[model samples]
Target: MTSITKRKTFLILTSLVSAIAILLLSLKPDTAIMDDQTLYEKLNNGNTIYYLVVGDSIGRGAGAESRRDSWYAQLERLIKKRYGADMQGQHISQSGATAFEGLYKLKNTELIYPADIIFLVFGENDRKYMEPEEFAKHYELLVREAKVRAPKAEIITFIESPLAVQEFANQIQAVSSHYGATAIDMRKAYRQSGAEVKSLNRDQVHPNGKGYELYAKTILQTLDEFPNRKAPSTKEALYVQEDAPLHVTTSIETQQGFLYKEPYWTTGKKGSSIRYKVQGNTIGAIIKRNPNGGMVDVFIDRRYYRTINTNWPLVKERYIIIAAGIESGSHQIEFITNDHGHRFNGLDEKPFQLAGVISATINSKGTAE
Candidate 1:
């Protein structure tokens, strides 16, 4: 062969190898690459490293066969094995919780203040019930609150599922970036793992045991990538105004059809109604859900707003946001039972129960009405 021909063949082969390398690099998980470990070592000192996990059902490890098989539990084990450090944390995530509900939980629940690390695993439920913009607003607020409470904590947000919508993932990435936190897009890791994403899920949403294992592995890999160890600075300009103090009231006005039960007002009669008045822009309800839970219509300022069906497969208590983004002032909220001899899951005569009401107004100076 001629010298020119040999050179041309070598050049072509080099170009092909380069293109393949680029493709593989592009297929890797979306995480920042860092080699420094000073902060990591500092956090791994002999003292216990407190952490917090906050989000939806996925965060609460719903589909795992047992608590030990959950992703968070597996991740804790991995951290202990790898770093030889003691760790402690709390998981305050609730099933069927949206971003708004997440924010409320963060505000109301007693968190581990000054935690060494925090994981946020929301967005799946938000994508189902909330607009992207509204979700973004609440998510940003949640992140900000975490920062304010745990200024020196390493905040990490997870794109929990492969089936998560693109918009919700984008919003999480954007908010994390803006707040100097790390956002791990697990979808990329799942796609690159060569596993069928559908097989990882127990149902349409929650992950099975095998799926949780994959989740833990992905999170461990991301942590190994040395994501930002620096915490958010309290001196930084705030993105949203601080929320007012939350007001919770269990005192409610009920008609004769309703009977007072410990911790809840229960009624099997149709047309039973309860009323609450509060001063706030955002309002929510604390209610019970069971196999026989019935539906209740919500009214704001005397106009029907939405209907809430408090039915679940098991007896579970939930704090749900029923109304938000209303004008900042006094408002009247009502919940009326609509039981009509409906049977759910072989249970007859579904009943309505109320636990309490929660509200947050814009004014910080006045008491709850």
Candidate 2:
């Protein structure tokens, strides 16, 4: 009698446990369906105007407490009210994605096809790690993919913040221009309106609701200004600035990274170096070729890595090298000039200027740009 009773109790407990497991499994959120359902619903709706946003934290509506308070949502509202268009929106963004990471997501993802408009906002997170040239290459890749995935869509890119590194914004604009997409410089628009930078900012990086509203308004205005035409080209040049977050040997100078300015670097001897300590899976730099340019040795952790020959005929900014697919953590990079010589363009013997240095956590391959 005891054995029979015990067996019945054990069977009852197993059934209960299985029931709970099934319930938990049913309750688990389905990520693929949650965001995609709205997209599919709108795609099937004949009266809907679809907009897709690909970006970082700001695109994900970080500072806004509610989804409706986010800038993209607000922008959709304005368009619906003003033009009487039925608006639908989707944002595919993670908190800390750089342009390369965003592109990676796009390559491996599936979204609604043939969107009416696409917004690409990134680079705030990128500037902390990637150099301008690296940023531009990845940005271009993202744009190219957007164009392919949504052929009928007009792509628009927005500047994240005025306080962000200026070169990164310019790089975004340049990428947009290259792809014939629209580029909206929100920072400049905010300044021209005489709004305090902090008034729109929720944190050191993200915008508050009020700020998001302003950003939406600005985008709408910009859209109206050029309803039928592609955005005008920025064609901004790349350069390095003095306040750039880099550590360098005493022989290096900080007078090359500014915009529309002459680049000048003077180091009297060999072993004069430029260094940057960054956290990412990639590292690179933007360098200007000079007539007097020579070989520069690259080292990681004092071990020889590679050598860069900066000698060329043209005076132009170029991405020197990118070491990608590394482990995530702090990394040390040193660029030491091995030989500096006098050139046809200049008489200086010890002068080699770098436009900028970039580092990032992008681990993808075939992203060499």
Measured by TM-score, the strongest candidate is 1
In candidate 2, which residue ranges exceed 4 Å CA deviation?
1-47, 229-369
- lDDT for each residue of candidate 2 in 1-369, tens digit (9 for 90 to 100): 699999999999999999999887776655334333332233333246677888887888889868889998898788777665577776778665576557656655778644767889887877765567656656766777787677657788988774468888878877677767778887787777687878878877888898888889988776566444332333322221111122212222222222222453445346677665666555666566656777888877567778876766655444433464456567677777776545564444334666455655543333332
Candidate 1, superposed: residue stretches over 4 Å from native? 1-39, 43-48, 112-114, 227-229, 235-239, 251-256, 340-350, 361-369
Give the clash count for model 1: 0
Cα misplacement distance, residue 68 of candidate 1 (Å): 2.7
lDDT (Cα atoms) of all candidates against the true structure: 0.75, 0.65
Q: Residue 338 lDDT in model 1?
A: 78
Q: Highest lDDT: which candidate?
A: 1
As a whole number from 0 to 100, the lDDT of residue 16 in candidate 2 is 100
Model 1 lDDT per residue over 49-157, tens place? 6789888888888899999989988887887887776678888788888777777778777775447778898888777655666566677778877877777788889
TM-score of every model versus the real structure: 0.77, 0.52
